[model samples]
Target: EAGVTQSPTHLIKTRGQQVTLRCSPISGHTSVYWYQQALGLGLQFLLWYDEGEERNRGNFPPRFSGRQFPNYSSELNVNALELEDSALYLCASVPTGYSNQPQHFGDGTRLSIL
Candidate 1:
């Protein structure tokens, strides 16, 4: 199967700016997750979307939001961007019925705050 794909592989922004990153899940996958990977810190879960609904989210601020499309693709939006938000934003997807299976990740979007 093909892997998940992310667009705009790299982004540069300044504090207070807003950005939107997109993700396309692998064919047949219905759940998508957004994560942040900064230096030193490992991957931190951000948001979860399933079947076009926002199901759950991590301990992030309200500035972070996302939604799943009917076709299963997803998007992650960051508002009031901060320097601390500069990191590799990753998107992963898993088949809805097989929670035990490992999620497949995209190459990730590197967001740099100026």
Candidate 2:
């Protein structure tokens, strides 16, 4: 049973630069979701992909988007990043056809915009 993993546990970037974060879902999972958690803030859903297609997305701007690979891994892409974008980007994966199943999250990729 492979658990989720994120790259570059911490990320630092200047304002206006783009960043891409990676995530690998646990084995046997089929849904991957991306979230943004600012300092002292709650989780904000960015995108959701299940069965290799976009399933749902939050009210984020177009710049916030992502996709799930055939292997169930996923990536989040934020373009024209802003200082406000500085936050811990977390990814969660759920089981197939189990929307209510508790989502398993990775440690998250911390993105810092100067």
Model 2, residue 58: what's the lDDT? 92
Candidate 2 per-residue C-alpha lDDT over 10-111 given as tens digits, one digit per residue, 9 for 90 to 100: 989998888889999999899998999987879988888999999889989999888889999998999999889999999999988456989999999999
TM-score of structure candidate 1? 0.95
Candidate 1 lDDT by residue in tens digits, 13-84: 999999999999999999998999999999999998888888789999999998888999998999999999
Best by lDDT: 1
Cα deviation at 104, candidate 1, in Å, is 0.3
Taken over the whole model, the C-alpha lDDT of each candidate is 0.93, 0.90
RMSD of each: 1.1, 1.0
Q: Name the lDDT of candidate 1.
A: 0.93
TM-score of each: 0.95, 0.95
Candidate 1 lDDT for residue 105: 96
